[model samples]
Target: MTAKEPSVFRQGFKDGLPIGIGYFSVAFSFGIAAVSSGISWWQAVLISFTNLTSSGQFAGIGLIASFASYIEMALTEFVINMRYTLMGISLSQKLSPAFKMPFKLTLGHCNTDEIFAVAMSRQGEVSPAYMGGLSILPYVGWTGGTLAGAVLGNILPFSLSQALGIMIYGMFMAIIIPAARRERPVLFVVLTSVIISCIIYFVPAFSFITSGFSIIICAVAASALAAWLHPVEGEVADET
Candidate 1:
C-alpha cells in the first residue's frame, strides 16, 4: 500500500523472471525425459501442470516408465515432497495477518527452494500477493517448457540432447553449491541424503523405486529433526 512497499513487490517481480528462466531449462528436460520414456506430449504438459516439483515429476515419470502401480507412485511422491510442508510453515510467519490464509493455501503449491528463499528473505509486513505474483510467471514458464520439450524431443540430435540433460543437473549443483556453503544444516541434509541413496541402490528391498526417493526420505527426516532441535525463529515482531 505504501510507496516503499510497492518497490519490494516490484523487486519480487523482477527477480522472478531470472528464477523462472532457470526453472524453464530444468522443466524442459523433464518434459523430454517424460516423452522419451513413452508419455505423450499432452500428458507431459499435464504432469507439469499438476505437479511443479522436479523431484516429484521425475519420480512419477519413473513409476510410469516401469509401469509401477498407482500406490507406489503416490507414496513415492508424498514422502519426497514432505519438505513443502515445512516450507509452508516458515512462509506463514512472514505473511501479513490478513494475507496469511491465502498465502498459506496457494503458495504451498509453488513452494520450491528458490521461491522459498525469496519469501524468507523479506523483512516486514510482506504481502502474500507479492509471493503469488512472483511465482505465477515461473510456474507458467516451467509448464510451457515441458510441453515444448516433449514436442521437440525427437527432432533434436542425440548427443546434443544428452548434453542438455546433463546441463540441468549442473544448474542444480549451482543452486546447491551456494546454499551448501553457508547452511550447515542443508549441507548435512544433502550429504546424508546422498549416502542413504547409495545404500538404497545397493540394498535389495529398499530399491523398490528408482525414482530416487532416498534423498527425499533423508531430507524430510533430517529437516524434521533439525527443525525440532532448532525451532524456526519466528517473525521479528515476536521478538519485540
Candidate 2:
C-alpha cells in the first residue's frame, strides 16, 4: 500500500484492476455452477480460493458431482490445467534476476491467465513486487465473486440459475472468438476440438469413457493436430 516503495507495484495493481473486475462475472458463474454441482457454499468458496482456475475448477466440480474416483479427478485436473505449467516456465524467463526462488514460488501460486498476460506484456524483467501487486486484487475479486455467487445460489430460483449458467460459456466465447477470428489455426483447432468432443459424446462406443477423459482426448488430439498443421514461428509464438 506504500506508494513510495516502488512505482512498478502500483502500475501493476492499476493494470490488474480491470482484469479483477472482469473476473467477477466469470467467477460468479463458476460459483453458481459449483454449488449446483452439489458442493456447499463454503466448499465452493474454498475451491475458488484454493484452485484459482475457471475451466479446471468447473471440470473438477463436474467430476465431483458425477462421483468420479480420486484418480480420475486428479488425472482430469492435470490434463486440463497442464497449460499453467507451460505458462509458468515461460514466465520464469521474464522475472528479474533479484527475484529468488521463494518469490517465484509465492507468485507462482497466483499466476492466473490475466496475471501472466499482463506480466508478459511488460517491457522489462518482471519484479516480484509488481507481480505481488498484480495478483492480489484479482485473487480477491475471483474469490469474493465466488463467495457472493455461492450465497446467491442458495436463494436463486432454478430457472434463473440455469440462465446464469450460460455466462461461463459466454465468457469463454468472448475470449476465443476474438483470437479465433484473427487466427486460422486457432479457429481450426477450435472446430476440430468441438467435432471430436461431439463425436465422443454422441457415439455409443465412447460411452465407456467419462466426460473428463473425453475432454482430455479431444484437447490433446486437437492441439497435436494444430501444432503439426501450423507450427508456430518464433515471432508468432511471441505474439501469442
Candidate 3:
C-alpha cells in the first residue's frame, strides 16, 4: 500500500516467473499420473488447487488409487509435507516486521520449495506485497496446468501419458543439481539420501515398510547425518 511497495511486489513477481513456468510441466505430469491412476480430471485439478504440493499430492493420489484408509493417507501426507512447516518458519524470519499474522497465514498457504528459495535469495527483509506477488503466478501455473493436463490425459496416447509422468522428477533434479554442484555439503546430503532410499526400496528387510515410511526414514536419517557433518551457522536447516 506504500508508494515503494509496488516495486517490491514487481520484483517478487519477476523472481517467481521461472518457478511458475516450471510448475506447468511438473503439474502436467501430476495431472497425467492422477488421471492414469484412476481419478477424475476435475478431482485431480481440485487436488492441485487445494494442496499445491507435488510430493504430497502424488502420495495422496497413490493412496487414493490403492483405496487406503483415511489414517494411512493422513500419515503419508503428514510425513511428506512436514517439511513445509520448517520452510514456513524459515521464511517467516526473512519477512519484514510489518508482515503480520494475517499476511503470514495467506503467504504460508502457497509457500513451495522454489518460492521459499527465491524469497530467501534476496538480501533484505521480504515484504508482504512481495510475498503475495511471489505466490500468484505459481498458483496459477499449478492449478491451470493440472486442469489442462487432466483434460489432455483423457485424450493423449497411453505412451505419451506415461512419458509425461517423469517431468516432475526432472524438475526436482533441476532444482537439486545446481545446488549440489555449488556445495559439497549439499552433494553429500543428496547422495546419502539417494543411497539410503535405494537400500530401503530394494532390500528385503525394509521391503515390508510402506513407501511413505521409507521416505520419512531416508529423509530424516540423511538430513540428520548432513547436519552432523556440515551444519549451517545461525540457523537450523533440514533437507526434505
Candidate 4:
C-alpha cells in the first residue's frame, strides 16, 4: 500500500467526523421513537444497526406497531429507499478501479446522503481505504446513538420519551424547508405529498389504506407528478 493511500483514508475519516456527529442526534430521536412504538430496546438498536436509514426505519417501526402486513412493509421500504439505488449508481462512477466488488458492497450499505455528498465532492476517484474510513465513524455513531436512546426511552417518563421522538420530525422539516425554498419543483412535490398524505389520513373512504401503503402512494404520486411537470431536458448538472 502506498503511503499516500493512508493519508487519503485519514482525510476521508476527518471529513466524515462532522457527519457522524450530526447523525448521532438524529438517530437518538429514532431510537426513542422506535421504542415508544412498542418494540424492545434491543430490537430498535438492531434495526438501526442494520438499516442505517432514518425515514425508512421510522416508517418500518410504525408499520410494525400497527401490525401492517409484510408486503406492505416491504413495498413501503422499497419505495422510500429507492433513491439509494440511484446514489449507489452515481457513486460508482467516482470509485477507483481498484475498489473491488466486496468493498463496494460494504460501502454501499452505509452510503447515506451526507456520506455520498462528501465522497462525490472529492477531486478524483475514491479509493477503497478512503471509502472504508469514511463509513466507519458514521456507522458507529448511528448505532451507538440508537442504543443510548433506546435504553433511555425505557427509563424516561412516557411524556418525555414522546417529546424526544418529535426531534426526528423537526429534522425532516429542517431538511425539506431549505430545499423547498430553493427549488420550485421541490416545493411543488412537497406540497403534493403533504396534501395526498393528509387526504389518506383524514378521509373515511381512504381509511382502508394502511400507513405503509399510504406512504408509498404519497411518495410515488407526488414524485411522478413533479417529474411529469418539470422533466429535466438534458443531462442534469451535478449539484455537488
Which structure among the candidates has the greatest TM-score? 3
| Candidate 1 residue runs with Cα over 4 Å from true position | 2-5, 122-126, 166-213, 220-240
Off by over 4 Å in 3: 1-4, 36-38, 154-164, 235-240
lDDT of 1 by residue, 40-157 (tens): 9999999899888888888788889999998887778787776677677767666776575556677667777777766665556557667767787679878988987898766767
lDDT of the candidates, in the order given: 0.73, 0.80, 0.82, 0.81
lDDT of 3: 0.82
Predicted candidate 3 versus true structure: per-residue lDDT over 123-180, tens digit per residue: 6778898989888889998988888888875676778767756665665687779889
RMSD of 3: 3.8
For candidate 3, list the clashing residue pairs, or say none: none
lDDT of 4: 0.81
Q: What total of clashing residue pairs does each candidate reach?
A: 0, 0, 0, 0
Count of backbone collisions within predicted model 4 = 0
Choose 1 or 3, whichever is better by lDDT.
Answer: 3
lDDT for model 1, please: 0.73
Cα displacement (angstroms), candidate 3, residue 105, comes to 1.4
Kindly report which residue stretches of model 4 are placed more than 4 angstroms away from their true locations once superposed: 154-240
Q: Summarize candidate 4's per-residue lDDT along 119-227 as a digit string, tens digits.
A: 8767767788888888888888889888888886557576765665565466457567887898899899999999999999999999988665677688779988998
After the best TM-score superposition of candidate 2, give how far the Cα of residue 5 lies from its true spot, in angstroms: 4.8
Overall local distance difference test of candidate 2: 0.80
Question: TM-score for each prediction?
Answer: 0.74, 0.69, 0.79, 0.68
